[model samples]
Target: MTEAKRIPKRSEMDPKYMWDLTPIFESDDEWEKAFQEVKAYITQCQALQGTLGDSAESLLKGLRLQDQVNMKLLKVYVYAHLKKDEDSTNAKYVAYNDRASSLANDIQNALSFVVPEILSIEEDTITQFLQENEDLTLYRHALDEINRQREHVLSASEESIIARAGEVTSAPSNIFSMINNADMKFPRIKDENGEEQELTHGRYVHFMENNSRRVRQDAFEAMYDTYKKQKNTLAATLNASVKKNIFYSRVRRYPSALEASVQKDNVPSKVYEQLIQAIHEYLPVFHRYVALRKKVLELDEHHMYDIYVPLVQEVNMKYSFEEAKDLVLSSLTPLGEEYRDIVNKGYESGWIDVYENEGKRSGAYSSGTYGTPPYILLNYQDNLDNVYTLTHEMGHSLHSYYSRREQPFVYSNYTIFVAEVASTLNEALLTDHLLKTTEDKKRKMYILNHYLDSFRGTVFRQAMFAEFEKIIHEKVERGEALTPDSLSELYYDLNVKYFGPDMKVDEDIALEWARIPHFYYNFYVYKYATGFSAATALSKQILEQGQPAVDRYLQFLKGGSSKYPIDLLKQAGVDMTSPDPVRQALQVFEQTLDEFEALVLDK
Candidate 1:
């Protein structure tokens, strides 16, 4: 009997691989000290609430104070949440996260008067103040953003009441996070060696990509079965989350949750709608790719689990963490030496948590705030997918790196609409590098297959999610309750529509929504699709046009929230307002598919 492989406990991880948090806080004791001090600042923020409309100096003082408190608050919250994500089972850090969350709500409530107070001031008065005070000019854009939402801004008391409920409103996402990361259990499945192995969120992808059909099917059933058991509870959590979106949308006077969400980034609802409409037009392109996967794999009937395995599986393209870093650095050469050096610095510095451990969060992200290194968290597996993930996350961290260096703290964070652009652009560059460098037909096919898979996952799949979010929100707005069966039915139907009739859409795949954390993100998944489209266009420019294109892209990264996301992308040379980018990306996918099929038929 083979002993099942166990996840390493946090205490057992190598010290060099773990991120160094001392840059943010010297120790837990220091974090504690900062926590108390920020609590004091939160109270101080409340003192300036009534003074914003008094005079220009008073308004500037209140605004500056708000930035000071928020910067401090973000630093504290980032540290706590990162610590919590390291190992959610650790009670101490969990408490730290909870406390930080509560303090965040307190800070929001304390400063809630700022927006309404600003709105209360006559627009001509604000114009005069900006003209009179050079310091106030710094916040002209920020004030303009506030003024743009004048109809949405409630009275100060009402705004404060809503802000105080932040924690309560956030409860659904928090509960789902705990359940998905900490409490849920997956059944053991036999690996390729026929030895029993425990399934995890991090390991599930590797399992699906396993060469053995039995392994893939077993892991698929085990993964979905686990979620199936808690379907009702998961449905309730999702229902609560959707309701929360609706509640806030109505309170803020938005027409719907989708508008409320896109409004933050100043994106038109048509952008979201256009993505779905474009993908629908390109469904045949995706269906053709699905048919190719079926024919190449030589499967009599293809299941959802069958899609992830490479078409050229005979070539073992597995890579180590060091090798992945080397590949990523080499691939990003088009961006120049300065960009490459920053990636190398991130590697040498304590900017990334490089591997998975027991109780660690699944998936990957780049996270940080002003006055901190943009840190990346990855539950790395030694595969080509993880290599793409490395470059993707590095893209995000580097975006943060440039933004923080160039913009003021008030404009530091980019909108979520443009957030995925930097990340997916790296994935495109990596694919281009591998295809250009690899001489062997098999290796090239594998890279091509992976690129297409990236498209399938990022564009087709996420657009499906975007549609799901839209449908569910609309349904709930019409007073329809989202039951477990209804959610599963709707999800299954979407799968059928997207994947086409060539593949067998398994019943278990219906429960996949139960496992996705992005649905909790409130219309967030569509950006992955839109961003990938924008990135595909930009990657072409960078590759074909050279240094000039790179200059424009780097500038876009540095712009942050100083300009709207659409405007920033316009500066970067991609006009996302049109459907051309999506259609252009699909053309690339089809051209690649044509080449892959030629290789197959010639063989």
Candidate 2:
């Protein structure tokens, strides 16, 4: 292959494989026009601020205009973000993204008066207005949700101060991102073939999944050794991020930082606590799975570095991006014709940026706006994981497509709370299809192992992180200091508890906390645990309950933020309030484990 062909520039790639942003904005000129329009809309919203309490018509008009401006802003922001992500090196797109973000803060500050002003009006008056102004009924639920947070709603100045503080508060994350992605470097390590491979953030995970113990260890140690040198810096950055959380929580009058964080999607504190509690009960099962890995790998003792390399590496399933598209679309047929057509269109219609290029974002995500087709950015690697990622992201894209097409702009977009369910459900379906079609016992065993590992990582492992976050926050809340040594000790103890005494917990594993960006996100990891449980239940229902379940799942895809996330999942037949789904998901994991052990052991 030509050197240029192996790694092509964004401009070198065919436009057919890239996402069509023109649907949202015909050109940069048009986008620039919309950008100016965003400023005009902000001024327009600001004009209606003080007059909101004057009449029902005024309130209704302002809310509708708010929706319009938000949608326009979303279009601008999503476009800029997608463009920036496509090629992070592009200064034009980066500036557009930065400008769009500033515009958001301006809009937020300008419209800060709307909520507090509406809250200033009597509840009965607002209700009567909604009753009198039939048009205002469109925003009735949205208004009610805002009204319900009256206790937390501060003055306009206070809200604007908080809004503006976002830029400053975001510094820790920004610093961490720059340091982790840009400044940090890892030394070259020998691959499984004994070839020296220079380690990058992107290659570290891949290196750990190598079949050779030496490669995994070298990669792990080399990665962490670098982190170890900067442990104090990372800990300080994390502490600042945590303090930012505490600041907002305290300012917003939330009882705790965790509450303030999950409150974004109206998730209850109990859901977060319940996830940790349930996972604590199942840690033994995860440890046993770890033991199973050690036995299968035929290792006398396996360290933390050995955890990632699959037990059954005999099945090397590599699908090109094109083949993965076909696999994803075929696997999703259970979702019915409508959803399948959307996936097919996405595959054919350049809705995805399918391959990696210089300066593109490293991870995968489905992003878009209320009116436009959702776009996915992926660094496709052609491995089994990449195939699952294709399905996962397509799951998100289809969810956005159905939701935006079916619901009004006001309720079109879903929250992150329910986002993971759609993504993970795709993986579940893809796993089912792969396992059912693959007759080879080893591949079947590998697929089963994949499912189990997914459950362990997503449900149990995230829950463990959630628990750690909770503990640390509580400590901070209680006037405790967070230093590198202190955080490491806490993290190491958690690992010991979670992984059990069977596996050797290496010293470098404690530094793993420093590497995780999610720790900076307060009380967010539990959602993945809960999302996995919900997705597991929904995927099972679709496979077994057939059309009826598919019908409900389709409803969920279209519901968006029309309802609270938990209620939406409840509509899809999973009650996240109870730990039933978590247990049910664990039961599935146990069953998969049993099958894999039976097959591999010839039992």
Candidate 3:
């Protein structure tokens, strides 16, 4: 095996390989100019605050100005954050992002008065305002969305206080990351050849997938033990973060913290409940899969660490970054020529930061503002994983491109409820393409297992996480102690329920929740589960129905925040409020498991 190369500094890379920040702002000096101009707009918004109640004309002027401010603010914030992500250690960009964040808060606080004032107007009068000004129809949906939040909308002062406190409330998440990633260290674990390898977070995934069971066990133990040691501290940070959610929920008159979180996306609590209930219905399939894993791995005693080890360990499938790009393009052809054209642009243009550098942000994400093309951040390694990552982020970029092109700024951004659908849909399409194209038996089995595992991870595991968050938050709400032991105990039981009786529920595995950054994300994991289900259903539609389904899916990509997420998905042909999509998704998982079992029998 060849030695891995160290990541290069940002300055050392070819400019063409990097995302073109010039499209956002030509220079730092220009960025500075826009930053000051946003300040003036913020002040302009403040001037129009009380005047919204004066007349329809006054309200229209206020809203139009507010939209301008929102657009400018998005551009400025995204530009700085993109530069900051390129090199997190760069003090200049760090300061740039920090200042951008503060400016965002300023704008939020300044504009906080407008909504409450608008809501203060009589509904009939507001309707008359809209009737009198035909031009104001553009903001009709926008206003209706805000007016729907009438009960949740606090007083101007109260909202201003909350807006300003946003930075303060988010500190626990920042502190948790600092401690979890930067401060803690895991013990070295002996590799298959008996050489000590230092266990880092990145290496943990590789180690978990190692062929040697001993190596996987050692790495798991070391990683969890490190987390176990800090459980109390981690719990405290997580608890405070939960409290922040509860605090906002209480003040905003929401019935629960989960409600407060999901309601922002206009998603019904029933969607969240349906996900958990639907996954519970599919637990038997998971049990069967686990039983089969125990049999196929041929272990005398199955353990938690054995789960990630490949059932077929001999296949060494790898692809170069260039190859990954080609595969992604071919994989997405079901979406038709126009959609594929946008993807080709993504490939030809510098829409992706395709490789890791010394201080680049970890993992991958698709990000952009209304005025610019979507940009992707990726720590790309040349393999099947990177290919999937490429397609996933490209899904997001294409979604943004269509939305921005089709809608105004106010409706150009989609919420998290629908955001994951595009990315996961891309993965599903890519997986089908790979399966159809590959003829090698070993590669087929590997891809088959990979597809099953992806569903398991995205749908089932995230549902378990959603359940855990619900349990912990309810415990906190009931005034129960959220000690390390209590949190671990609940988490451990969920693991047992999720993975089933075939695999040992290792005691150390209880501390697994301690290190998950998503718990602090407040009911966010459930979206991954729901999104996968929706995507599975939609991908099947696009593949089978061809042109008609492709048209609906493209319309969905362009819908953005114009409607509630549930409504948007319904228009896209997945009714997430019902359990049908989840049912279909789990059925697909079972089918994949059956296929895997047949392959193993042949072997």
Candidate 4:
């Protein structure tokens, strides 16, 4: 077969071909006009605070105006951000993003008093006000959730201090993104054809999928080498982020940073610890998979670089963009006609800005606002992986679409805790669909490899990162400095633990944490593992149990922020607080490994 066509240039595509944002704002001029209005309204919010507790009518009026201001501000912010992310290198777009972000901060600073002042009123009085005002019905859930956290609500002075310190607090994550995306450069690696290719985040996956072992090894080393050289810089950035968490937790009067961070989503620290414990108990399954990899590759030792190579070779399934869309539609039929219809609307409408373009965001995401259609940004190539990613991101878009349609603006946005479930469920269905339909042994093995890799990365690898994040946070909580040596040693030790006794834990791998952007999110990496586990359990329900299971899952999609994340997930038939879902998910992983071993080893 002829070599796959080279990736096309962005300039070759028409600008009009991109996702139409006219529905969001008639034009950039209109967006700017609204931006100015929002800037003026921030001052209006500053004046509404003292009036809030005066009377039910006055409080209702003030709250309604604040809601309007917030919705418009979010729209303006999303428009500027979506535009900038589509072309990060553009100077004008960069300015737009910075201005929008600054305006958001300004709005937050201005509205800081609203919550504190609201909490200061007698709880019974506010409850009476909610009962009295018809217009405030939309905000009842939002108000109740806030009131639930009343004890944690700080004094007005403390709230103002924290609001003003937001930018300084986010400095580490900001610096890390700037350096990693814009400044860091990786070494070149020779491709299968012996042509040197520059390593990029976009190309790293392609290199890792190379049929040539030498190429994969070289690309891995080349990518990590750059990270190794900048290890000190990365270490400092992560250290500051951890310290920020610790400081904020202490100032907020929480016993620990993990508690402070996790409690925001109503997640107990036990949930976090349960995930680690469940995955640790299944370490033997991971080691078995590693051993199978070494056996398949006919190697005495399995290095980290050897992890991604396919167990079955000579299996190529190329998909066009249109074909991928059809597959996504088929895979999602489990979600019911209404759910699938909305997805179809998204496809027919300009919900997706499909295909790669110069200066486009490196990865994929589903982003939109309460008043708009959920929009997706993807750098799609016509491959199996791209098909899965399309399904994945569209899962997010549809979740947002359903939630916004079913709930009010205040409850429209769901927390990240349950965000990945729909996306990965789509993926699981697609995998099962492919395996059941395809008869070719090599293709079957290829599909199985993809499934196993999902578990390996999303399940095992993220758990490892979660463990590292916990260790570093504890260090900071104990008043220990997270220097480069200390961070690297801690990360490297975890790598050794997860990879087991067989694989070689290269020294260069320790610097891996420095390169990961998730570390900047402060105790956020664990969600990937939890999300996949939940998705695995949910997918089983949908396939084996049919409409009843799907109805529960769809209820979860529509729940949004109306309920606590864990409570909402429980409504969907997966109890995240317990370790059963995670353990069951790992069992599925081992079963897949057994199937993969039987197929490849006997052949």
TM-score versus the correct structure, for each prediction: 0.99, 0.95, 0.94, 0.95
Name the regions of candidate 2 deviating beyond 4 angstroms: 1-16
52-103, model 2: which lDDT tens digit per residue? 8888999988888888889899898899888877876687887897888888
Rank the models by lDDT, top first: 1, 3, 2, 4
Q: At residue 90, give the lDDT of candidate 3.
A: 82
Query: Which pairs of residues clash in candidate 2, taking residues 3 or more apart in a chain or in different chains?
Result: none
User: Residue 358 in candidate 2 has what lDDT?
Assistant: 58
lDDT per residue (tens digit) for residues 5-92 in model 3: 3447888987767898888899999999999999887678778877997888998898888888989988899999888778776879
Between prediction 3 and prediction 4, the one with superior lDDT is 3
Clashes of each: 0, 0, 0, 0
Error of 4 at 276 (Å): 0.2
Predicted candidate 1 versus true structure: per-residue lDDT over 1-603, tens digit per residue: 999988898999997888988889999998999999999987788888778888889999999999999999998999999999999999999999999999999999999999999999999999888877899988999999998899998999999999989999899899999999999988899999989989999999999999999999999999988998899999999999999999999999999999999999999989999999999998998888889889988999999999898888789799999999999999999999999999999999899998889889999999999999999999999999999999999999999999999999999999899999999999999999999998998998889889889989999999999999899999999999999999999999999999998889999999988888999899999999999999999999999999999999999999989999999999999999998998899889889889888887877
For model 4, the local distance difference test gives 0.83
| Model with the higher TM-score, candidate 1 or 3 | 1
Tens digits of lDDT, candidate 4, 213-323? 899889888988888788888888888898899888888788988888898888989989999998899998888888778878888878878887777777777798789
Which ranges in model 4 have alpha carbons more than 4 Å from their true place?
1-17
Model 3 is weakest, by summed lDDT over 10 consecutive residues, at: 1-10
The global C-alpha lDDT for each of the candidates, from Candidate 1 onward, is 0.93, 0.84, 0.86, 0.83
Better of 1 and 4 by lDDT: 1
* Steric clash pairs (candidate 3): none
